[model samples]
Target: MTKRSFDQFFKNPRHWREDLVAVGGDFSVDRLLYAYTHGIFPWSEDPIRWYCLDPRAIFDIHRVHFSKTVLRKVRQKKFRISFNEAFPIVMQACSYREKDNTWITPGFIDGYLELHKKGWAHSVEVWNAENVLVGGVYGVAIGKFFAGESMFSFESDAGKIGLFHLFAKLKESNFELFDTQQLNHVTWQLGAYEIPKLSYLDRLERAIKDMVPWVIPLSHD
Candidate 1:
């Protein structure tokens, strides 16, 4: 299968929720990886229509905030976090519709599962005391960077546990950056801020050159 070239996304990466570059392109694993490596991603509100976004706002590792509430929850140890253990399950869970709608369509799941199989994508799962999976965050990882896709929680603060562990582990492993893609109310609360596209691309260029394997240290508990 021939994947679409990244050049087709746009000539410039600096923009704020402007417009779709191209729609209806195949979401091939190669294509998806290429998009992420180039700081572009596919977002579809209706699933039938996909837009490629290159956001100015991104999450820096130093800026990923933990509020007092989130900090307290992380301290509670209510969930056990694991990585790449149950990606298919977590992907399905992230795609599950808690609200009236969802963008994680069948197409999206199949494409990402392929990426996961190739080790270009990964997930961090949070399990409950009973060993049931409660929350997870899945994203594409190229080299030293992780671009977060979606996170879902079955319990309060479950998703935060997964995220906290992900950030902690990445920092320990010498990872360079985590791209949350767009800045919104949700991402803002998580400490994502806007940078010029030139600034981000410079960092991304270096990040994608270094390899930092996804690893989660075993909990002594």
Candidate 2:
């Protein structure tokens, strides 16, 4: 499929009125990278709609919050954390929500798996005492910017544990942007807040140009 630039589809000023931006594109690795670096992302996959939200949501790497209960779980070492250990499994887990429909289609998985193999995507995995997977989060990274895509937990507080570690990794690596895409209850608890789209795009432009490596430690608990 031929790829088109963001300006091509976002010419209508009305497109800025809502978060939808543009619809119908392939989920190729290059397309994904281009979209994300430009403050755009694919939230759905049937026809593959791309979005750059008006009020973009993000977490300040240095200002993440952990509830007292989550802090206790962290202090107790309730789960083992690993980086890039099980990217496919983590994505699959995030896609399986019994109570709601998911936007993560098979094509989306394939596209991101390719990105993982190319070192542009990464995952933080949580494992129980027996080493079975319990929770995880996955996202794409470009330069100093990281776009967190989704997370899932099978055990209480497990997903939060994964997010805590992910934030730590980003902070440690001097990442400048941590885009959660949109705010939800979980993200709100983690200290995510919104910035106007123009502000977000400005930050994104600088972030994607500053060279930074994803040198997170292999594992943590």
Candidate 3:
């Protein structure tokens, strides 16, 4: 992929038309990191028409909705949660969910795996009482921001439980924002709200400067 200026290539995500900075390039580790750091993420319907998205809406860390219904399910704790235990498998499963549009192609998977190995990507995994992997969430974490990419569940409420735990852990770790790329029904129900690009960028700028310890280390191969 050709090198693009992240600042120039990125603007708050818009859906009325294609709002992309650059397209048609390789998925290199460097490109991916720069994109996420600057609030840009890739999306393509056909795998060939890749576009970077930095949506206008974001999940305010303090405003995340935990509905009584969802909270009740979360409290039931039908599953156990772990971190980084099965990152690859969790990511692959998240890539292919029935009837969902996927940007997590093989190349994207390889790119994120590289990010994981570098400690820039991480997973929150949920397992059943039988010790079977059931649900999980994954995203890119840089500074105090954890940009939620996707999630999946093999059983009822597994993903929701995983999300609840993920938020709990993020709070403990002092993360500033939980960025969900665009406004959707799922996040709407979860309490994410849309903010204008100007405000989002301001918060994003401050978020990138928080020097809290990353949830994982970047030392190994």
- TM-score, every prediction: 0.84, 0.91, 0.83
Candidate 1 has its poorest 10 consecutive residues by lDDT at 45-54
Q: Once model 3 is optimally superposed onto the true structure by TM-score, how far is the C-alpha of residue 65 displaced, in angstroms? A: 1.7
lDDT, candidates in the order shown: 0.75, 0.85, 0.73
Error of 3 at 78 (Å): 2.6
Q: Rank candidates by lDDT, best first.
A: 2, 1, 3
C-alpha positional error of residue 125 in candidate 1 after TM-score superposition, expressed in Å? 0.6
lDDT of 2: 0.85
lDDT of 1 by residue, 1-221 (tens): 33344565443354435545555666787667666766777776343344434435677776688778878877887777788999888888888885666678777888888988878888999999999999999988787888888898888878877888888877776778787767878779988887766677788889988644455456655
For 1-221, candidate 2 gives per-residue lDDT tens digits of 23456458543323466777678867777777767776888888888887878888999999999999999998898788888999999999999988897998798899999989888999999999999999999999889999999999999989889998888888777789999988999899889999988888889888889644366654443
Native-to-model Cα distance after best TM-score fit, residue 86 in candidate 1, in Å: 1.5
Off by over 4 Å in 3: 1-18, 45-55, 210-213, 216-221
lDDT of 3 by residue, 1-221 (tens): 33445444444343323446556545677777767665567775344343434446677676688778768977776677888889899989898757775778788788788888888888989998899999999988888888898989888767878888788777777788778878888889888887765566567778888633366433222
The predicted structure with the larger lDDT, 1 or 2, is: 2
